[model samples]
Target: MNTVIDAHNISKVYNPTTIPVYAVNNVHLHLQKGEFTALVGPSGSGKTTLLNMIGGLDRPDEGNIFINGIDITKLSANELISFRLQNIGFVFQSFNLIPVLTAKENVEFIMQLQKASKQQREERVKTLFAQIGLQDKLNERPSRLSGGQQQRVAVARALASRPQFVLADEPTANLDTKSAFNLLDIMAKLNMEENITFLFSTHDQRVIDRARRVITLVDGRIVQDTAEVSTQHEEAAAVKT
Candidate 1:
């Protein structure tokens, strides 16, 4: 598999001169295409900071980040903005949507920014909404939908641009158990079917259990990076042995 994201010696400090708080320090990471990964850590472990650095939302004080071999840290403001728009999809905990826009409109917004054809945008929104079980709610605005539905729409919106990898920060933070499972099932299905890479930052065990790979961070350093096997796998192995 191709390396979709490469972070080399990344370091970020809140205040360098006086009482420096190192948010992230010497972090080296790489993500392969189609991999579903979660960065789990305690509060202030630099998960969000590292995620921001990878997403081009924040710049690191030192080191470089590469997406598909392009050094994003070296790009100009406009260039980086364009790159991020085209390559990365972001899903924040807030489910940021235009208040007045319908779910369909919200999902279409990304492709509109990409200058995709109207036919393409419409087709994608239709398919994505259907895939996420939101086809019936297409005309409804965000305020009209439930928390779970809103998050589903947000997931649909993230995939609208057909980005290389999706960065989701606390995607299921507000969902109930059923909703969270539903969202995770949808995302996992999409990952398998479309081979879309997903890198999410979360602390929830439900999210952690669903992830294929778990990367744990402690005090801004990755303490654990290992492939994850589901409970079903463990049970099956026990029976076999």
Candidate 2:
């Protein structure tokens, strides 16, 4: 598999106080194309900090991040912004939808920033809303939608730009069990069907169970890395024999 993201000796430190605190300490990770990976850890374990560094939303105090073989640390601010907009999608624990905008409008917002043609934006937003089963609610604002619905809209927005990789921070944190599972199912389907890589920082067991690979972090260090055996892959291999 082609490597989609790579990190080397990444570290982040907070220097507000007399003594510096290392949020992420010399952590390294690599994610391949089409991989569904869960970055699992407790609060303050540096999962989010690591994720932010990978997404280019936050820079590491030390170390380097390479996305699609480009060293992100070497990019200027404007170049980083352009790279993130073109190649990365983000989903947050909070839906992060603008309350005033309708679902379709919210999804269209990112495409608009990318300077998509009006017709193209309309077609893409409509298709995404339909895929998320929110076609009927596309005209409704976030305030009018349920938590699950809002998150679905957020997912649609994240995919609007057709990014190769998505970085999600506690995406299922606020959902109920049913909602969380449903969201995971959608994400899993997308990961397989679209061949889009997903990297998540989550404590949710549902999210972990759905992941093809799990990386556990404790106290700013990776403690465990495991790959789940896929039954479908096994079955296909058996059939060919």
Candidate 3:
């Protein structure tokens, strides 16, 4: 598989005073195209920091990061911004929707940034809203929607740009069990149907069970990496027996 994102000997340090805090230490990771990966760790484990570095929101102090074969560490600020807009989408724990914007408007905003035509943006947003089962909530503002509904809107906005990769930071942290599972189901379908790669930083077992691969981090370093066979594949093997 082609590598969508690659990191080598990456490290991040936060200078609070005279002492520097090592947030990430010598971490290396490679995400293949179409892969669904979970980064699981306890508090202060640096999973979010790693995701931010991969998403170009932050820079690594000690190493290089390449996304789609381009070394983003070498890019200028303007270049990095453009690269992020064109290649990556992000879903946050807080469902970072503009509260005043309607669901449809929130979804259309990113496409507008990409300079998509008004008609194209409208059509795309309509399709996405319908796909995420949010068509009825199109005119609702973030404040008007339930937590799950707002998150569905966030998911729609992330896919608005048709990005190659989506980085989700604790996407299920605020949801109830039913809502969390629903969001995971939508993401899983999107991953399979659109071939969009997803990387998540989560401690939730629900999210971990859905991932095709899981990377466990401890004390700022990856301690274990494992791949699980998909349920569909497992069922097929059983049927052939």
Candidate 4:
């Protein structure tokens, strides 16, 4: 497997001098390319903390995170931001779209920061909008779209940078059942057809049900790692046993 994320013995401690809470404790996680995985946990289970560390939004108090074989824990603050812009994509629960920009402009914003040519940005935005089935809403602002449509635009923005993987934190939390399902369908199709890797930090059953692998974290520790087994994998395991 081509491992895109390798986190080793990572820990995040909060209020270290006082209460000393362990948000994440010595967690080891590895994600391969093209895998659709869900990180499931109850609130306060440290799943979001772990995801943020992996995405370089925060650094671990101890241990290392390697994305595509580069250790991010050692990077300086500015370097970390640059690395994240190039390597990771994030979709938050709140649908953090710029209020003024249209869907097309919102998606193009990141590529512009990366210094992509105007033509490159425009072409990529069109292609992504088409892929997300939001071509018609390209000119609509977030306020003009439904919750689902806004989230789709968020997904397109996340993909605009062509990052190695997408990290979604409770992306379906704000939507109704229908909207949640629709978003999941689009994400699953993208994962299957485009070989995009997604790691979701969510408690939504809708998201969990669609994931190829489900990882359960409890009290800042991984308690279960389960993946759907294909026929070949089942047969091979039987033979080995």
Candidate 5:
């Protein structure tokens, strides 16, 4: 698989002169096309900080970030924003869906920003919703949908721009057991069948078990990196316990 993202000696800090805190230490990580990985860590372990840098939501104080071989670290603010929209998708912990928009509209929002045609947007939304088992709730607004339903819709929206990769921060944190399993099923299926690349920060054991690659971060540094794990079918089954 081609390398989709590369971070070299990345670091981020806040309040350098005062009570200095390193949100992300000199950490390095990479992701490949069609890879499903989980960034597991304790609270304040720098998972979100690393994700924000990769997604271009924030710039690291030191080190370089390259996505698709493009050195994102060199891009200006405006350029970075444009590049991110064209290349990366983000699913925040909060659904962040517009209250007034229906599920279809929410998914169409990003495509609209990309100036995609109505037909194209509709086609993509229809296919994604069906794949995620949300075909019937297409017309429902976030307020009307359950938390899981809303999260599924958010995932669909993340794919609206057809980004190379999706970054999900604690995606299943607010869901019940059934909802979490359902969402995981959709995500794992998308990774296996559609070859959608996903890199999410999660503390859920179930989510961790489902990931093909598990990267553990501790105190802003990567302490363990496990890749090339075997098929997780058995693990997934056991996690449903």
Candidate 6:
């Protein structure tokens, strides 16, 4: 199936017993393979909330989220954890790398949890670092690398297990302009060459500009969803809103 994500009538409410506030209110979404999509809106628009639910980090109160035909919202806690490990990749704003681990080690950690063979881990890490143009920094720790380099390592880590799709929440929020553009370049290359799907929750205009599909949210609902289906030059110009 082409649909990697299918969310139906999903809703999340905070303080439902008292001052009920709907963080995500009955939203439906579907993402096909190879899509580079941006979920954007103002603060409190439920971008992160919806992303978390789709990534299996949080559950919607009212509906189901299906990832590759599996209903993640119905999975038990332990089942959900295992499912996420195998099927979902996450890139967060903080560049969440292990402090003591080297770049190679940090990327390989998830593979270790899945009990990948040493050869498999080593080869996968090598390929990912090469793809992200960070072969020299493989042995360096997160503290030794610059913010952009660290974020590249984080991207490598996210791709280690070959997740169905990647969910990145404000990945460029802490990056400088040059760094953000560099990261976007790498991600766009991956999306085009490797057909890796990415869904991002971001307020950064740099990210929004590069996305092939843009989903806008307002007050916990999807207000607009625009896609570009044209020649390369035309697609580049189309997302410039």
Give the clashing residue pairs of candidate 2, or none: none
Q: Estimate candidate 3's alpha-carbon lDDT, on a 0 to 1 scale.
A: 0.92
lDDT of 5 by residue, 24-108 (tens): 9998888889999999999999999999999998999999998999989899999987887789888878888899999999999
| Candidate 2 vs. true structure, TM-score | 0.91
lDDT by residue (tens digit), candidate 6, 1-241: 3999999999999999999999999998989999999999999999999999999999999999999999998899999999998998999999999989999999999999889999999999989999989999999999999999999999999999999999999999989999999999999998999999999999899999999898998989988887523445576787874
Q: Rate the local accuracy (lDDT) of all candidates.
A: 0.92, 0.89, 0.92, 0.93, 0.91, 0.93
Give RMSD (Å) of candidate 6 vs. truth. Answer: 4.3
TM-score of model 4 relative to the true fold?
0.95
Q: What pairs collide in candidate 3? A: none
* Residue lDDT tens for model 4, 99-122: 899999999999998999999998
User: Candidate 4, after superposition: displacement of residue 50 in Å?
Assistant: 0.7
Per-candidate TM vs. native?
0.93, 0.91, 0.92, 0.95, 0.93, 0.93
How do all the candidates rank in terms of lDDT, highest first?
4, 6, 1, 3, 5, 2
Better model by lDDT, 4 or 5?
4
Q: 1-241 in candidate 1: lDDT tens per residue? A: 8999999999999879999999999999999999999999999999999999999999999999999999999998899889988999988888888889999999898899999999999999989998999889999999999989999999999899999899999899989999999999999999999999999999999999999899999999988887534446778899999
Q: How does residue 72 of candidate 3 score in lDDT?
A: 96
Residue-level lDDT for 114 in candidate 3: 98
